[model samples]
Target: MIFTRFTLKWGKRHWALVTCLLLVCCLVMPQWASAHAYIVKASPGENEILVAAPERLTLEFNESLQTAFYDIKITGPDGNQADDGNVHVDADRPHILETGLQAGLGNGTYAVNWKAVSADGHPIQGAYVFHIGEPSGSPAGLSDLTSGSGSTGGPLKWIVSLTDWIQYLGLSVILGTLAFLLLRIAPTSMTREPMDVPGSYRLLWISYAAASFAALVSLPLNTLYESGVALNELSWRLIGSALKLTSFGQIWMLQILIVMLLAVTILSGYDRDRSIRARIWSSYGSLVLVLGWLFTHAMTGHPAAADQRALAIAMDFIHLIGAAFWIGALTAMAICLPPLADKLPSKVRGEVYWVAIRRFTAWGIGAVAALVATGIYSSLIILPAPVLTSLFTTAYGLVLIGKIVLLIVMLVFAWRHARLARAATGSRLSGSLKAELATGAVILALAAVLTHLSPGQPAAAGPYQETKTTDDGSAITLQVSPNVTGENQFEVDVKHADGSIVNDLEQITLSLTHLDMDMGIYEITIPKNDTGVYKAEDYISMPGRWNIKVHLLTKTLDALDAEFEIDTTKP
Candidate 1:
């Protein structure tokens, strides 16, 4: 008796704690975008060096690109006027942005800094470095390379993350709860005589309101991310820009409307005696509306701009609904099922719980099967065959692997509980289901991060810009462009105290190291350019701080060494 009472008390307290942890994990962890405003492809690609400078710059995004709200700045060997100072968008290809390069450019390292606006008003910005002729010690404007990550601050990111977490949570609740009603409850509900499930309705309302609130707040949060403006300082102009110009805004508005319709249909269905035929049609209408709402999500993600988009969008739609039914239903079980079993008349208690558990087990099985199938399809098209190896090699791929492992674990728990129910674990099944919910909670949290990460593919895509000086007052400010876990360009700018470029350095070499894992040193020569800079192209296969040792051979000093560190950001 003491153990039972203790277990019950702990369960009651810990349940809320667990739920809060789920949301906290979703918010605090490094956020991965859900492919809302993802890049489809770039002209030179990340860390790619061209033998000759391209005539112009072109960028293609997954969603419609808005130039009016964009800031495309390029600073290379010659300082900021590398481009013709105009970004052009073709009427035929609003999704593509292009700008002409300045005439008579020489061979040197060039860094492209761009901030493009998605139709949803979110600004997607990044910097890429390419070698033109030969390497200068460092490009003229190499110090000016802006990676765009700094453009949006921590406050904006956290606010955006919080709202996004709420959105995901809300989506799980709305879709999963409604699914439990239509699929698990409604058909059998006819036979159960419709007892007053006050807790169930209350749970439904909370989900509806949470989802509605998240969807509503999503607009302002989108504005905050795009404009780099604080939530309070977000003017009507910015909000209007996001809603009118971005794909996310348009889709979000439509969702609010559908959410209202969904609430009406669900709330009305509570009345069991009110014309069963009408109720069926209303449920069917609500289901159709829910599918429509899900399409908006499909349209706004990586699929919207990806190759074979129709296939990707269809797969993503099914994937989300399946996930909602599975995770969301688990949430409903955590919130509603225990109370439901209690409300059943004593004579029918055990039988009703058994019927519901069996029914939900089948539902869970279908949802899992759907998730697996769609997940495979998404991986294939998004990452492509050439980049498949990057999954195990890159940070993004490692995170994806972690998510897959957790999913497998969650699946095991689901399978175990189904067996326990079949063995008639009775009230013990309640404890078992709660355990399953905890595992599933983590799976949902990881899912939120997966979308933002590089698909580890064609669009496969970091931050390292620092300046260091030597003893003789000669500055060897070396900048490693695109400090991602893949390809990168290293440029070392050797200049005198008078600020004149040093083109006559006898020899220059570099060493890259990651001390933590004992990931040894990678050394290479950074030869001098016609323009007096030293540079070389190499791929770094990890995401962390890299210790750089720059060795310079000069007449005054036999061997002058300058050391500095560059921090690479994981994609």
Candidate 2:
């Protein structure tokens, strides 16, 4: 095979040296990983009732945001545009987004809708409402405004995940197969003529082609994601703007360029009769290009947003290479070993299998060590000690747990194969090798999903409280305990003007409306408790602005209404 012919003539010492260097690279540097951008502060503040209309709307995120493909708008109670329609990031602070509102705004509720791209290229968006003077009901069709606009859900997310899986799989195959041929097969077969495994070479080509195609496809997908435009609305001009303006687009372009160069190098230098020095140079050159390609993946992922960005990126890079070395090499062995074994004499084939298995076992040990070390560091960085308890409860953590489980299964298979190799029975271990490769594929798929999910933290907990005065001068205090996206306790206390509890109401009816999406109204009746506090328990199905309307009826057939807005968040 052309790829096998380009394998480097490195001994055991060289392999050990490279492994130590990677370990040093990981241990010497460390940083805290940061996930997608979220609102840290807002000008009008969520659910704040203002005495006067503000001239501008501003939002600040926890991290610096991308300049390209961001939006900030304000809509009035009449469902018309309230902002000047010119949104911009602050010149001095890239994390802050601001937009000017129209002059002489009327007194009513207003919704601030925003969308932004994080530094690591993930798209994040949300909506919140702040009343200009008093809480009137939300504007008509307000819920339909930004519905399904977030890139976090829908068919686009699944498509992005699929592309990520393909890219990871393809890169693993390319890097792993090369490592296997150079470290395991070439050293032992140097004295013999090179093995003519056409199937093995074909696999490498297919992987390379797939990786290249995925890299190309990701360009348009990323454009769609960042720009927040419909698929049908995507144009070459928008794509060009994204490529020229965003960090993600630049990194992707660099990766594609490297892949093209790597392809050219491989095709132009494929000669079986090349000199030893030329072969060594070609092998080292290809290795550098492949490592560079892997580096781009690290640069555009979560690690790039870490506090200690350089070290974090280095660790991520090493982690990816280790995965490729283990999973990719196993795949190569599954394809190449059987064919090579069939072509040799029975006695010679048994000896070759034993030697190949032993060498691969050594490589596996090093790869596993690197994977474990890097994996632990990444886990700590992504899920800090404070949030470690949420590991099994969160989407990111659950996917990580699945990957760890598969890794354990792969280790068991490796251990069994190692035992056979040590006993000189490695020739019968093809089934175990295939099983390990299949498990690794599942692990990679889980990893793809993990990349798309935001790490979970302890949900923000507290009572959402508000007080309003009815037309009759009665004080109405409403409180929703732990106002998150789940079941919550709603307590309403009605007091006379003199501060004594009023226990004469006929009944208390509570109406809940989701201000972000049109899920319809949810009504609940609150019974007066022994303490004279009207209370009820109900569920808040999703995260967003919620309007709770309280109706109180006196025993004399008199009715009074009070409304409170509660901003419910995700748990």
Candidate 3:
């Protein structure tokens, strides 16, 4: 009600200004947007036959991407690199990426292998061919280079998810404990100090320590998450480069500052009655630290990609603060406040409980409103009208739905607790508060996964996906590309029965069958290849796993069929 009144008093002009700012962000904010990042257009173009080779290669995408991760390796007709300099993002345009080409070349064909990560934090990659004079053969190394690009799969995603949950959970405890001490216990205590409840200090310390530890572990974990690399074989070069060059690196470095400041703020105790100015100044300083933390968080997540740059960030900040206060305060109430209250005289219990309840409920109402509003706003940003159906259809949507369900359950408990707080002298939300915290953990985990999920927006390009090798020995390498439902490119690298490269083959045919549906056999033409490599392009109308049979024929050997499955997970 207070927030509502404030908004109304601020007038329609302020709201209009907010709208205009959002419009700017939506149209011009390069830092804050994309559902999925992909190459929108390329200089040479995909599978183009050009009379002359381009002097420079430029790639444009739908999203602003970190150039640190954008790698370009152009192999010419002679199986050698065609480019001279490192790829760089266009100074004026963040989405436009370019690399200068090495000249003096007689080209047959060239393959551009690219890998880039969106600012919103999705990996994308592709391999495309362009002919300078005439097509000779498929570029050999490229097939392997682009094989498993753009996939956010494997165990690392889950590990990243776990780390994210810890960070948020720990934040909740810090905010909740600190708020409770400063607001409720400290005001009325004999010392009129923030540490009236010694248990509150302990709670704050544990949460602070846990959060700091999570932050330390998460840097490497986040780097691994971004690179989609295995822990044992993580590229130190990649981590080092990211730390030095990327926004994520900048955010991590800032987190270090925030951690130090937060520790200092907590250590500098407050005696409000003795020195209100110092206490007020310290609170202001803490606010700045909190804002910095929120800003850094937004820089790495959806808010960076949101259309209205400032508005989106504001929403993210409010959402975080609200959730942290509500969840953390409840946790502190259940853990720290109750025992302290028990130690107090029975005469004072009623007054303390009622007053604390009044203050918290007011805070809770505001927090709940902010969470609900921002959650909806963010959802709309991620999933627009037509594709909004994906809110139920996609895995991302399903997880969001689950989060909403848990929130609704907590809201119901909250309504009951509010009534109990007003009516009872000895307030007890013990069971309900615990339930809320438990539900909140799951909510944060779901959120961690949700942020990583592709919103399946129209702007999003197909998932860059791959399939595991069917066999170990001299087996065919099958790449099912742009791993979303649509026209998919299937490239088969023919390896002999003896695990040797079969560059000379008489006949190679590729056939497909829908594994999930009753759709029968469908075969596509195998393009001309002097090499044993078989390339096929066809429309895969729907998503899901589909079985493909690659039939190989030779003059000396009998026919052979290699099996692999294509998983078109989502668009």
Candidate 4:
């Protein structure tokens, strides 16, 4: 038997320095990430009063949308269907959704409720109202219209997170174990000898099966999530639609194919002759397949939606690989090392254990460095500047903080284990290794929840007011109370050149258009209030710069139009 000899001189001071660097990175890195798809503009805009009923309704999002499981419905004031039952995405513009409405609809408020799956596979839904001529009675409020949609805290969401956690765990183990075997174990073993760690191999097979099952099950769960359907409502048709029509489905299918190929490669190489060249090729093949599998996750995640998409995806992939090496290898060592050492001769046992631990420590340091650097870069790119200051308040930020805390704890355990490895004391190391693995599992759970959360913090609730002078020497002030997305009250006060209130207006119409995207104009009728103020409530839908044109019809039927630009923020 031939054993490889090497010297490793890492100590506590080095570990402390690394720990401080990680802490500094965490403190300085900006926080708060982005979110899934949202409505950027809508025709027959929320709470808008139209002179004539529209032939169709349209919605435009901030990002490209998936047609699979997309739904938009119009309900008339009488609670009957107002839409033509055919809703589809615009061919030329992937971000726009349009549906024909029943023609010649009577004067009343109509509801437009929409649900869609974003390109990144997250499901988002919203509801709004628009009136024809005049609003009769009150339509269902936004909250009431969205009441039936599943909340983010339900059993279904948790179940999906659980599946995600399991899949992550399984992948980590598979990749980490392979890395451990090829990079750490193989070089030390004789060329003719079979790497005979039955426990580790068994763990790998179990992980493979679990990961494969989780991946398969995730497809249907994703269908349920995207379609906004209950378990009982799930069908083959919906699943098939998701698979064929959605980016997530395509990526998932590719992942399954990779898994199949991975299975073949693993099985084919399992009992092959223990030649160095063959082992090297097999290891490289497995590593490449595993990386491809990991890439699918990055494609379906928040990074795919980022502005610097390619770089974001690459960073996310590197983060995943680093995590697999650190957490996965630790788990493998905890389970495989003790028993293997017990079976070896006393003198050789210490040497083997020392070699494994020393190699792992070296790799672990590199993995940790990669994780910290990529994590910081991803956070910076994913979150907007305004949101970074208030990171602790958002759910995503809190979860990420928890993950970081766990990572720091795991690092301490790793450092202790590395110190023990210097003495070649394999027996004393199992407890710390298990501790690190446990911490990693908790971190994975937090990560599962984090992935499902929107990193954008809700915009501050405050009225946005701006004053503009009309050509007729009148001062028109536009105030949007609670100028965040969703429901907001729009009030316009008109004053004559002498500062007297101008109250005798035939009608006040406000035309709103999103300046960031060409989503068409949204005309809203601002009715006169009891106090002589023209005010109405409507849904802003999204956050960005908006151009609002307020048209005033005097008692003599003369029209005056004034334009005002305002910025709305996320809700």
Candidate 5:
């Protein structure tokens, strides 16, 4: 009866303490619920590079962006179709959209044009120039790179890195502590060291309870963000559909694995030979954690095509594992330490926990090392600007820097606690250790906020321009030029014939409209410039989709209107 009452009283007090800690964790972390802007870098700075008729052209963004919104166009000096096929996203980096142009682009100015929407749902359009030193005899279709009118915007992408950070830190604290308790910390038993401590159940309950909550909440949040659905109405169907579309669906499988691991542990606790069963169950749990790494994060990372992909993957793996260890250990400490500290012999308790912590310290060191090295390498690949500038200017870079700083502080606190705990001075040392743990709590909160930042998209200037022109005859020609000073010239020539031209037509008046707007429409009087030819010439400012409406009115012909779409390139 006394033991039962003691357990109940202890549980009440400790649960209250942990509940407060959970609130503290939530309070310190800031939520980023909206989209962030990013700028992917361009070659030779937009319109500044001079290529010697290179075989290909490339454009890069600030973040590991998606290419669905990508658009590209290339036209020759004579306003003729020099592009062969439609533009396409690079198979290697979906974030990289590219297209091939016809060969033998003569030495005259050629336009290289492009437009795209960012992951944040913002539309970005621009143009650039690259000169082929001297025009070649290669046919236009040799490398068909053309643009058309019927283009739709890419699906909107959401930023989930902030939530990922929160998940990472929380998992670290919960898992790291469990591993320590199972593998290193011990309670005295009849013939062997007991992996289970008196209050360990409470610790596991709190850790797993919180973890389960995070998993559940993150699921809906992730779903809601991706589908643009309200959280309350996010149905299984929506989730299923989202999973089929995006890689995040794998989390559902991971959640199931965790549940299975939990079930095995619970079942083993009731077995006659609990010790053997417990070990088996714990090993299964560890396996689940490892698999969790594979199913969720490893699957969601940047395209694994770079030469340093292996290194980046390794770093991300270690970083995640280290996070799990840290957060897991903290959760264990919060749940177990307060209730059990007074029950065990001072010397024995100190030796056990200190040894466990010593083991953990090595793991922490490795995780930190991997996180730093691999993180830098990863940043170099994705973030806009040079490595140094990205670290400070970009949103992703700032968040990483914040995480690194907080981690350093946490390490310092750990070092101080290690020194104090190593002395084995009993209660006074425990007090200090608890204080250090408080700092760990703050560190976890910071990590949660860090997860929300989006990488890439650095601030940069746009070099895009647009122009419109209409022909008096039935045929309308629109020329798009990317005024890149140092690069090759690009031009787009559009032709429209609505059977509205007549031989006796003396004058042809044409008007231009760009995307239903006519603020700066340029007009062309046909048959005059061409000496009886019925086409007009005008310049398009940038590379992107355009709309042109031809107005046909001849001296003896009825008025006719026709609409057509054209994608111009930047030269």
Candidate 6:
């Protein structure tokens, strides 16, 4: 009950602190957006004969890509790398790579291996083989070979990384400063007078707040740049449109709330005559900040769209809030502990600092537990199949592992810090604890980077999708695309034995049954314009064998029912 009471009272500080922290998180989210699926276009567009050797090999794609992980490999007819070396990104083209090709690649089959990030951050990779007609060992030389050459729009990436770094740093500073202020300024007991923090410490908050605002603004710009939008064309109209869209709605509200809270807090600090109201505004501002944290990442697409969107949203909310609290508490400890220790006699300082550590350690454990439990649940709910192998094979999955590792490291440092705090050593162990906090800073930074990694879905280890077509002198043709989404479109045409077919079937009922149970059904009617032909669109929920029944209305008052067995599983 005392722990709960203390948390409830002190928790208000976590609100603003977490809000600012979440804002920083938004800047890092594009790293995980959309799994980066993209296709890089090859030069010559499939069918161009060049009389003279081209000086360069070029590639284009529908979307801008992550330069950090993009790769391109070219193989000559003999299946050796044309350059026999890895292709590197050229400063010239941000998204493209330029590499030298081997001097002689005699005509044969040439292959291109490429992996690119899709506009949404998904990693898509594939290889394409092309034939070279001429048979000369003379290696075709390339003066330059890089994609995204003319548009090495890499500034956006750096901006994002920098903003993210500063954001976390700002979080540490803001929360740290506030914690110091609380420990110093708040009354020790009901009868005690409030002790104001020195003007110098207050000044530091000014810089921290400014940095926080700059990061907020930089996030939107960085997002646009990452999406390949031209800076010059990034007008208010586009921003307005984004704000109106659901994807950016949460972020927009978060930013607006952050601005309002900061303004109120600043005004409260300056109103000189309203110290009581100022404290109230500061408290409210902090709460708004926590809410802001909840909103900033409200839009990061994950756990899939609408599959279990509500649950995913809830987990994301909790994750951000817990992160904010943990970060804020650390920041508070760093700023307030030393000064408070110096103010009180060494003995009392030891008791107070140790008590604070006890409180924070409990908090950290609870937050970490929530993070893990919800994170795993969210992962399981979104993925087609949840398996450990996905961690190695998928970007998102791999990133999750990396984050877990960092979390463990952070816990170790926290544990060490807790031990020292409890020991209350006469030796100057505060600096060592500060060093531990610094380690926590590194963990948060790595957390920021891992935020961008995609959590790839576990590839279905199920059997291949099998499609069958039995052409028994029937006019019907069925085309099926086997994806897990369960959508299938088919056309059936009936013909007379004389080869003259009725123009259209009045009514056609198509039903799929499995072992006498009706699995799915569709009803379609054909117009007179298309004689004896009927078309139907339907989906089967899962992969299995089923009997397809087709009821056709013939030209007369007669009707015919035909049945076909279909095996839905395919390779």
Positional deviation of residue 29's Cα in model 6 after best superposition, in angstroms? 23
Q: After superposition, how far is residue 64 of candidate 2 from its true place, in Å?
A: 0.9
TM-score of 6: 0.50
lDDT of 3: 0.66
* Candidate 2 colliding pairs: none
TM-scores for candidates 1 onward, in order: 0.66, 0.78, 0.71, 0.77, 0.52, 0.50
Q: Residue 405 of model 3: what lDDT?
A: 96
RMSD each, Å: 11.5, 8.2, 10.8, 6.8, 16.8, 16.8
Q: Where is model 2 poorest over a 10-residue stretch in terms of lDDT?
A: 1-10
In model 3, what is the error at residue 214, expressed in angstroms?
1.7
Clashes of 5: 59
Candidate 1, residues 1-571, lDDT tens digits: the string is 1011001122554556545534543343321222334445667554455688788888776557664457656677766578888786667988787788888778777777676755433455656566676665455544444332222334565555556556666667766666666665422452442224335566667866776787788787767776665557878888887778677777888998899898878766665767766665666666677677767777764566555567667878877787777777777656666666565665554444455556676666556656776766665555523345646655446766787887888788777666655654455346666666666666666665554444522122344666777777888788777776545788888788789987777788897776423434566687655577777886654444568899888655567688888666544
Question: Ten consecutive residues with minimal summed lDDT in candidate 6?
Answer: 141-150
- Residue 457 lDDT, candidate 6, scale 0-100: 33
Residue-level lDDT tens digits of model 6 in 215-272: 5676466446433467777766555544553233345566656766665664554444
Q: What's the lDDT for all of these models?
A: 0.63, 0.73, 0.66, 0.75, 0.47, 0.49
List candidate 3 segments past 4 Å from native: 1-33, 76-79, 104-109, 133-137, 141-153, 185-192, 227-240, 270-284, 344-355, 384-387, 425-427, 457-571
> Against the true structure, candidate 5 has what lDDT?
0.47
After TM-score superposition, what is the CA distance of residue 326 in candidate 5 from its true location, in Å?
A: 3.0
* Predicted structure with the largest TM-score when compared to the true one: 2
lDDT of 5 by residue, 1-571 (tens): 1111000122565556545544543343322212222224444232232454545556665434343335566666566755555677666775566666677666644566665544432334545344455433222322332221111212312234344544555456546555656655332231133345556555555555655565666665666655544547768886675555444555556675675576566445434465765664664565456347433554344423233445444545555665566656645654555445465565455544454455555455555555555445455544534557657755556766776776677667777655654554444235545655665555555544433333433322233333333444444333322422122222223233554324444555544334422224434345533233454333343233345555555455655455556533322
Superposed model 4: Cα runs more than 4 Å off: 1-5, 9-33, 140-143, 146-153, 185-194, 272-280, 345-348, 423-426, 457-571
Give a tens-digit lDDT track for model 3, residues 304-387. Answer: 666665777777777778787888877777776566556657656544444555567766766776777677667767663444
Report the C-alpha displacement of residue 15, candidate 3, in angstroms.
Answer: 18
Report the backbone clash tally of model 3: 8
lDDT of 1: 0.63
